[model samples]
Structures are given as structure tokens and as C-alpha cells.
Target: MDDLVLLRREFDAEEGTFLGGLRPDLVWDKAAFSRLEQAMRRVCAAFAGRDELPRWLVEGFWFCADWVPSWTGHADFPRPEPLEYYEGAVERLRDLQSWFVTGESPYLEHHEWPAI
Candidate 1:
């Protein structure tokens, strides 16, 4: 299978759940890959031929981080409200998803990664 497909499969779970928690391979951190593929598919469908989006956009697809959450609400709490790094990620993803759905995005690139 292609790397992009494999990455999307890693994130193919409920709306808000750990990607690897529900996967057979236990692989996580694949959301970026999925987003890129979806955008590519959309662009292709819209054009029905060579779209020629941009080099930066296509290359941005291979971006994301393997985030290991480390946060507990209380002494006995099972989990925290926002896992480390997840909160910011969720925010960005929300905007990106919205842009993708509307196709009137302000995002310069199709793919995006958290700034270093």
C-alpha cells in the first residue's frame, strides 16, 4: 500500500480518539497524510485532468509529528482534558478541515505542520 494510504489508515478512527489506539499496527500520527490525500483528490476531481497546484503544497503532504501525550488531570484521572501537543493540533486541524470542506481556504499550502 502507498505511504499516504497507510498514514490515513492510521488515523481512520472516531472523530476524537487516539489514532494508534484503534489500529492493528499500533501506528499513529497520520492525520497530515490523510489531509493531503483528500485535498489532492479534491483538486483532481475539480480539474478532471492536470491540476498543477504547486510544488510546496504537494511536498507539504509528508509532514506531521508522532506525538506522545503526557498529561493527567488529577492523581487518579485516567486522562487530561487536552493531551500535550494535542490541543494546539486540534485547533489547527479544525481550521484546516474547515478550509478543505469549503475550498475557499486562506491556507497558502494544502498541507501544514506545526511550526518548530
Candidate 2:
């Protein structure tokens, strides 16, 4: 069988802690992670499950940068509670996904899988 990685690099939003939640589903469904996903999915679907790794996803992180707002005209980080909560949820979702994808698999590992 071919590797899905050859199809496309895992999606990385280049979203640091600052952009955390924006790319929550990068590892699982790059298409759902950002607008760029639509085009990427279309191109990669043909090669899905075909190689060990794709150029775009050879690295663990798919993206590293996007639009970053400067604090010069803003209130600064450690933002308000509401935004914080939303961001936290987004981050949690990402973490949960990471756990699901890398934690374990039937063919690779099952006995040592953590108790999620």
C-alpha cells in the first residue's frame, strides 16, 4: 500500500501559540483547517495513499505563518476572557486531534496507547 503522506504534506497553519485555534484540524483534515485546504485537497486527492511523504507534509508542521497582527495598535496579548476561552477550546481541539493521530494505531501500536 502507498503512504497517504505522498499525497500532501500534513497541514500546518504556521499558527504559533498566537494563532493556535485557527488551524485546529491541520493534522486530520487540512481542508477543514483553512481556506487553502480546498485547493490542496483537490490537487492531492489524486495521489492520496501513494507515498511515504509529500513535499508539503514531509515536516510535521504544515504551516508556519499567516497574518500576524502587531500589538503596536492593539491592546496586547493575554487577551480578554472570552477570546481566551475560545482560543483555549480551539487549542484543546487541536491537541485532541494530535493525540488521536499520533498516539496509536492497530497496525502500529495498541498495547501502549494512553488512556485518552
Among the numbered candidates, top lDDT falls to 1
Candidate 2: clashing residue pairs, number: 7
Q: What is the C-alpha RMSD of each candidate to the true structure, in Å?
A: 10.2, 10.9
For residues 18-76, write the lDDT of model 2, one tens digit per residue: 23443342222223334332233333334334544345542322232122223211343
In order of appearance, the predictions have TM-scores of 0.34, 0.25
Which ten-residue region of model 1 has the weakest summed lDDT?
64-73
Per-residue lDDT tens digits of candidate 1, residues 6-54? 4344344433334444233343334543453344345433533343544
On a 0 to 100 scale, what is the lDDT of residue 110 in model 1? 52
